[model samples]
Target: MKLHWSPRSPFVRKVAILLHETGLDAKVERVRSVAAIATPNAAIMVDNPLSQIPTLVLDDGTALYDSPVICEYLDTLHDGPRYFPAAGPARWAALQRQALADGMLAILLIWRQERMKAPGQQLPDWLTAFATKIAASLARLEADAPALANGHDIGHVTIGCLLSYLDYRFADLDWRAGHPALAAWHAAFEQRPSMVATRPDDAQT
Candidate 1:
């Protein structure tokens, strides 16, 4: 399998963490592919029309895309504990958490793009809305922090990645200030071998 990957993408980091947890890191070859919202890469578009990272091309020319689908597909390949619960309330909760985290990530990506624009070209309303949404997301995660200890799932991985991304790109926001419980949870999760190994700063550019 070959993965169209980028070192800095949280979505790609999710897949990388899963690969490590499942002992499948060696099974997939990483191809450094640059995928930007403003300018899509032709290489990635060949595998994923959206030009997204973490696009996995299997041996028989089958392609799996977006982080969630790829991670779930890889989960079936290993015998270890499942990152996705097989069924019941646990599965729904995990999936819901993943959706929240991924939604925040999507907002952060666009917020970042907006930040990159010249000050005069930036929209004030959009900036304010982005900040508001992030704060609300943090509050939701804070409320759900206790449930995070129940099990390590795709939700945990995705949330940890999102918090780390905040530290990586939005340090000025001081996200931990009002979310003590969530911060504490992330502090420990960030130390996992998978998380440490895939740190965006530590990745080779």
Candidate 2:
């Protein structure tokens, strides 16, 4: 398997963390592929029409994409309990949490792009919407942070990766100040071998 990857993307980091956790890192090769709203790479689009990274091409030439799908596929490739829970409430909660984390990433990336674009082109309405969504999401996560037990499943991995991105890109926001439980959980989660090993080394996209 080959993974279209980028160190700077939180979504890609989620997949990388899962691969390490499953002891499946060696089974896949990482190909550095950069994708962004303004800068799209045709090579990645070939495998994933959206031009997203963390696109995993299986040995048989099948493509799995966007972190969540790739992580689920990786989970099935390994023996033992899956990062994705078996059917029932456990599965629903994990999927819900993952979706929440992905929403945060989408808003964050768009905000970052807005910040980078020419000041005149920046949309205040868009910024307001992003801020509203981010605030609500974080508040919800903070209140529910206690549910994040020690399980390193897909939900936990997605949250961990999102927390890292928040710290890296919006450190000035000081999100941890208002969210003690999440702060504590992430502090411990960051020390996991999978997370530690996959930490982003570069600030560049």
Candidate 3:
């Protein structure tokens, strides 16, 4: 297997963490790729039309993309345990949580991309709207924190990566201000072997 990846991508990091947790890291080859709105890598487009990082190409030349789909596919390769709970309320909850976390990532990426443009080309209202969504998303996660368990798989990993990215890229937001439970949970979660092993270079910001 080959993975078109970038160390700085939170989505790529999510997949990296998943591979590590499943003991599948050594099984896949990592091919460095850059992906961004301002500078999209044409090489990646050969495998993924969107030129997205974290695109996995299987042995038969099948390409899996984005984060969630890639994670689900990798989860099936291992038999040790399942990150995606089988059908039931738990499964629905896990999927829901993953969606929310991914949505937050999208909002943050939008915020950063807009700010990267020249000030004259940026829309203050759009930036403000993205900020609002990011804040609301954090508040929602904070509220959903206590129920979080240490053994969580994909759902928990999603939240962990998103919060870490926020801390790394949006420190001015002060997300930990009143989110005690979520902060505490994240503090412990970051120590997991998967996270510790894949911590990106400081330049990831």
Candidate 4:
């Protein structure tokens, strides 16, 4: 399998961590495909019209997109439920947590875009909106941080990646100040071997 990936993408990181957690990392090959909001890579477009990172191309010429789908596929390859829930409320909760993490990633990406603009190009109102979204999302997550088990789940995988990206790209944001619970959860998640292995590269930032 070939994976179109970027080291710094939280979504990509989610998929990569899932593969490792499922012991499927060795089966996949990483190929860097830069397809940002502005520039779409032709190589990725050939396989995935969306030109999204973490796009997986299977040996049988099948393609998959988004972190959720990729992770679910990995879960099936392994015996027992590891990266995802098998049934009932646990499944719903896992999906819900994944959504929250993805939403947070979107907010952070928006924040990054606003920060990247020239001093005069930056929009205060836009950033304020993004910050507000971040605060609300974090508050919701902090209120009920998922209890992670020994094996990786979608909730743990996504949350870990989200917190790592926040640390790497939004270090000055002080996400820990107003969201103590969220900060504590992230601190605990950081100690996991999966997180330690997937820490963001400083050079990528």
Write down the TM-score of every candidate.
Answer: 0.97, 0.95, 0.95, 0.92
Can you list the residue pairs that collide in candidate 1? none
Off by over 4 Å in 1: none
- Give the total clashing residue pairs for model 1: 0
lDDT comparing candidate 4 with the true structure: 0.82
lDDT of 1 by residue, 102-172 (tens): 99999999999899899999999999999999999999999999888889999999999999999999999
Best by lDDT: 1
**At residue 1, what lDDT does model 4 achieve?**
95
lDDT of 4 by residue, 1-205 (tens): 9999887888988988877777788999989778788888899999899888889999998999878998898888877556678888888888888998898898888789989999899999998899888888877877776454434579877888888888899989777887776777788878877777777675662
What is the number of residue pairs that collide in model 4? 0
lDDT of 1 at 47: 85
List per-prediction Cα lDDT, in the order shown.
Answer: 0.94, 0.89, 0.89, 0.82
Q: Where does model 2 exceed 4 Å of error?
A: 203-205
Cα RMSD, model 3: 1.6
What is the number of backbone collisions in each predicted candidate, taken in the order shown? 0, 0, 0, 0
Error of 1 at 30 (Å): 0.3
Model 4: how far residue 178 lies from native, Å: 3.2
